[model samples]
Target: MSKSVVPVNIADKLSQFSELWSQKKVAVLNDYEVKLAKLKGEFVWHTHEDTDELFLVISGRLTIQLRDADVVLEPGELYVVPRGVEHCPVADEETAILLLEPAGTINTGDAGGPMTKAAEILN
Candidate 1:
């Protein structure tokens, strides 16, 4: 078997990708993948049927919109969107975020709309 070394400094690795909304995967194990994302503007309103998504703000602010409420997360703050709960994400300015979710969780969820990303943000 070939052996390879995985590097440290996930944040530094994440910085290599400059595309907006594209998620750079830092690590993965079994059924989950840890990712870093740069977010701006508005994301589609949607929900995951089988998994909850964790969002941790690394820099700037992250706003999560629910049916009747909106939660704003600042740096060092974190939020989890429960499975099957509809939500949208918006950032007035550039924001850096970390996310943990099942490997196949879809960003657009079941509700596909104009804002749905045609491609999965993977690197």
Candidate 2:
């Protein structure tokens, strides 16, 4: 069997940040990056005009509000918001999630508001 480069504990990385909506890169594969973030409350409404976003819930609840419908994700669940789709994510309580996307995807996508965080931060 092939061995992993190393084990990454999602919970351990999640504990490295206390602020909500901040993401930390945990791993990389080719052109994609694996990230972990702590989320709560509603994120800014935005769209990745050039790329899609994948959200995997590690714990707690995540509600992705889409233009036409809302998707609720639970632990072990995942959702991919297609490119150019405007959506908002809200967490009634603190939630932990993993994201898979192109290496340079900004957290706020096209919004780029004050909440937009640099994508290079790693754990």
Q: Which tens-of-lDDT digit does each residue in 12-37 have in candidate 2? A: 77777887788888888789999888
Candidate 1, which ten residues in sequence have the lowest lDDT sum?
114-123
Off by over 4 Å in 1: 1-7, 113-123
**Local distance difference test, candidate 1:** 0.81
TM-score of 1: 0.84
Point to the candidate with the largest lDDT.
Answer: 2
User: Which residue window of length 10 is worst by lDDT in model 2?
Assistant: 114-123
Error of 2 at 11 (Å): 1.8
Clashes of each: 0, 0
**Residue 110 in candidate 2 has what lDDT?**
82
Candidate 1 lDDT over 22-108, as tens digits, reads 666776756887888889999888889899999999888999999989999999999999998999989898999988998866668
Q: How much RMSD separates candidate 2 from the native structure?
A: 2.6
lDDT of each: 0.81, 0.89
